[model samples]
Target: MTDHPLRYDINLSILFTELPLLERPAAAAAAGFTAVEFWWPFDAAVPDGSDVDRFAAAVEDAGVQLVGLNFYAGDMPGGDRGLVSWPARSAEFRANIGVALALGARLGCRAFNALYGNRVDDATPEQQDELAAENLALAAKAAAEQGAVVLLEPVSGAPRYPLRTAADVVAVMDGVERDAGADNLRLLFDLYHLTVNGDDIPAAIDAYASRTGHVQIADAPGRHEPGTGNIDIDGHLAALADAGYSGWVGLEYKPSGSSTDSLDWLPRARRSSS
Candidate 1:
């Protein structure tokens, strides 16, 4: 509702994964998003460069930007299924980072969200942090070369991830920066998770806005579009803008009903006026 400078990105996952992956970006652009993020275009069996190139072309033809990419999930082939639980999976995780970096480079995206897989029962909290930090450090180094940033999002209630608190997220970034000599690494602040996990959203952003590179939002109850449930959507947007965040805010929520039914929120003017 406030006059914020930040813009939002539509993810194909929320809009058109039900359609063929190739048509997802085009559908998103037609829905009025100027920018779109994707989970993994690499999953498509198109030729080496063709997969990303076609997707990038679709984004451009549809008059949108590819702003964010989600590249790291633990299930990457031959890679460890859980980074937090299996510290030794760093090698495969590095390969996953490489794939994401290449995709970012090809798609002209500035950020990639790499998820630290589920927690391992064999590791201590301290050990998980150390392993995550080490793995992230390696990722940051690779991302830096592509002129992109890698962000770690804390899954507070999901103990499978190492970053559960703002402090924990920041600590991981700090560790990567210190160990890899790259301060460009950052945290991806998901407001839904933050609020659900009992974090003071606005206050946390004010404190660590500089370290936060991207944001995602969803209503608390159903993880649906803003205003669908009881999350202060307007207030959250204002807080993010006030904190000097100038990047794309991801609408990483499920549409409660039909995906297109949520188009009423697309026009920024309407969203702000609401």
Candidate 2:
């Protein structure tokens, strides 16, 4: 296996679905990961306090760092990606800010991903974009208060979702930074989605790595673990390192079989921190 210079973290939400949510951090630890990230682990816009406490405890007990998290994206299993751009759901998104920041502070997490909402039938693209910028600015301000950065990602295969290119997300990031006067907003550069969208992977790393807050990976054509499909994971990772990005590369791929069985591509040296 090639030596990857970047630090790595598993996305508990995607890779360890076979385990209970509270049990995933330990599973990741047992698998040799010292850091982990995940999508919002709640089904509702606001989860119960006890659930939050339990999650915090689970990570603490597992001795893994909570390196990144997503702000409340509603009903992920039901196909809702995020709420930041929905004008009607603006309050819901705002309500999640304090909770998210508190959790981030407790976990020493510095990266938060805020997915841009899909275009709504009742709202014009202009309206949606305007609403998204407003919410992102608010999120950026809140994240800054906690010394954390808010991230924007361009997802593929979701046509209704407006930001589908690195350029698209960077434009939104610029708007938010200008509006908020805060530099806490950055890109969540996921190579799998970009590859699926037919983006120039190497070019993207060169163009946006400096401004990227986090990076995620899965192989194209199947969104499975690396080496199971056609993405140059090593090349992009090398490019990111060359570009001076030292953030975590999140393992956000689905396993072809058991999740543990699919980790052969990750060299043991890259699995845990020194």
Best by lDDT: 2
lDDT of 2 by residue, 1-274 (tens): 4446889999999998899999999999999999999899876557899999999999999999999999998877667779999887889999998898899899999999998888889898899888888899888988898789999998987778878889888998888777768798888999998888877878888899999999999987899998888788888888898899989999999899999998988877789966
Report the lDDT of model 2 for residue 230: 76
For model 2, state the Cα shift of residue 159 in Å: 1.4
lDDT by candidate, in order shown = 0.71, 0.89
Question: Quick one: how many clashes does candidate 2 have?
Answer: 0
lDDT of 2 at 264: 85
Candidate 1 runs further than 4 Å off? 1-3, 43-57, 75-85, 268-274
The residue-by-residue lDDT of candidate 1 on 69-157, one tens digit each, is 87645544444324533565656566677666766786688897777776667777678667777777777778778788887777744
RMSD (Å) of each candidate, 1 decimal: 3.7, 1.0
True lDDT of residue 129, candidate 2: 89
